[model samples]
Target: MKKIVIPFTIIALLAACAAQPTAESTESTEPTYEAHKQASWLLGRWENKSDQGNLSEVWEKKNDSIYIGASYFEIGGDTVFSESIELIEKEGVLNYVVTIADAGQGPTAFKLTKSSDSELVFENPKHDFPQKITYNHKGDSVIAVISGKQQGKPHQETFAMKKVN
Candidate 1:
């Protein structure tokens, strides 16, 4: 009886080892998503500050593809400059078409590459503005640096922002 039990245990262990998956079989090509109920990425307020010490913007998105932003300046002790057109982000690019009553210098197209959670290469060719924005999550700060030339002249500006509730 003892001899039979030892042999049976060895056989069971060998069978279990054989049943394990190999490296190739364990790997899957399928994409997976986890539902994040605690992190409300789209339900917060965001803003940016200008290096000139007189300009800034406040932005928010409600529902799907409905983004609204406002520009605030300290021209004379805090003034509201203008609000931006509604926008949407898909894939890795942000697309915002021109809309009536926007505070831009003109009817501008807003496009930004959402590189990461805290970085974007924002451009408004219609307004002839181009810049890169970098953000720090812990500090809730976004730094904006303009690039390229405007109307045949170099365009440059730096801005920062803090996340608000």
Candidate 2:
């Protein structure tokens, strides 16, 4: 009886091991993007210190197709500049819109050029200053990059921002 039991236990353990997935089967499939899924990561406050002032942005979800953000800069105990931003899905594509307080122009729209789990890139070739805007999330920090042609010369600015609770 003991001899039979030992052999049965070994066979059962071998069967279980064989049933486990191999490395190839465990590989993840490519992720599909839903408009709201990517925007949800931005639903928080972010801040950074710069020579221009204390820059901050607050973002919130409005609906499945829209997310709103407000950005401002403070200098010498006063709010010097402000802008309203929005991420909206249009015609099956995502767009980033920026409306400044007194820019004397309509909102500028940047199309979504690239996106991933931790990064988003938008671009607008006709915009006067920034033609490309990118955001990359790494751990607890986000690096925001703005680059384009200024006066026919290339210019770029990077902001290292930390998320606020």
Top model number, lDDT: 2
After superposing candidate 1, which stretches have Cα over 4 Å from the reference? 1-56, 78-80, 90-93, 97-106, 124-127, 131-138
lDDT of 1 by residue, 1-165 (tens): 999999999999999999999998899944321111111242355564455446655556554445565555665565645445445555434655444344434555657544454444455554544433222344565564656666777866655557666
Q: TM-score of the candidate numbered 1?
A: 0.51
TM-score, one value per model: 0.51, 0.76
- Model 2 CA RMSD to the hidden true structure, in angstroms: 12.8
Show model 2 residue runs off by greater than 4 Å. 1-33, 50-52
lDDT of 2: 0.86
Which candidate comes out best when scored by TM-score?
A: 2
RMSD of each: 11.6, 12.8
Residue by residue across 1-165, what tens digits does model 2's lDDT show? 999999999999999999999998899954433855875777789999877789888889887678899988899769889999999986568899999998898999999989887999999999988999898987768888999999999999887888996
Clashing pairs in 2: none
Candidate 2: minimum summed lDDT over ten consecutive residues — where?
29-38
